[model samples]
Target: MKHYLLFAAGKDRPGIVAAISRILYRHGCNMADSTMTRIASEFAMLLIFQAPAGWRAERIGQELQRCEKRLGLFTGIKPLASSESRALKPKGRAHIISVYGADRPGIVYRVSRCLASKRINITHVSTHRTETSRAAGYVMLLEVELPSLRMAAGLNKSLGRLASGMGLHVSMRPVETAKL
Candidate 1:
């Protein structure tokens, strides 16, 4: 079987999965992994599926288009290269980083740049602006993978310097993951 990555986005509504799954079922596709979420007012889905070896990517995309038309979703598909598939899994320590400050531009960019320079991989991130003391404030929660050589203290120090420069409060803590 060959693996393919599917991306779909549309207005948030019910039955999106049923529509997508029906098409996949007809095409003899098996969903191996997937994540679906609502971002803002839009619904987005990312799926990794396996199909028969001879299946053409274009044919699956056409099927997806048909499903999209029926469900009012916009869809895209790509065949994942073997190397790409291997790199998605996280390695090293998993940590959660949080930053809070008065709402302003460049908070995310600055913090992300610092992490990027250190080769830190961000697995997931969520940010929001909310009212605080009659003023707007921002909060960001980031799940990141820290390199084996860098302990939590090192990460904290780096984040602290970035936060000091940006006038933000930053905290980093290791997250314990239990295998099921």
Candidate 2:
């Protein structure tokens, strides 16, 4: 089997998932991981799927083209290299980080870059623009993993300093992983 990634975005509406998943089903693709959400008025989805040999990206693209036209979604499909499929496992605890304050450019870039420098893997991130004025505010929630308890303390302090410098409020809450 080979892995592929698909991204689709359009105005939000009901049945978007149904329509897209139907096409994938017809194309013999197995959805391995996916994320779908509404950002403002737009609905966005990213799916990482696996399909049998000979199921090329071109085929999936062709299959989704019609769905995209019908659903008014801009879609893209690409093959995933083996290296991209193998992600690093978290060696420690999971934490949710929230960042918010007056909106400005580079918030995501700066914060994420800092986390990357620490080798903290960000599992998920969602951001929103809340205010629409001279002091517009933005909010971001990130799920991150701290590789060690010691790393957590330093990370918290660093994030605080970075947030203070940017005039943003940042908080980190540790999450308990469930063993089912």
Using lDDT as the measure, which candidate wins?
2
lDDT (Cα, tens digit) per residue for candidate 2, span 1-180: 888888999999898899888878888888888889888899999988888878667766675788788889998888888667665666668899999999989999999999999999888898988765566899999998788888888999999999999999999999976799
Model 1 Cα displacement at 139 (Å)? 1.6
Per-residue CA lDDT of model 1 for 35-111, tens digit only, reads 99998889999998888879987776777777778778999888887666554666777889999998889999988
Runs of candidate 2 with Cα error greater than 4 angstroms are: 81-88, 132-135, 178-180
Best by TM-score: 1
Q: Per-candidate TM vs. native?
A: 0.87, 0.83
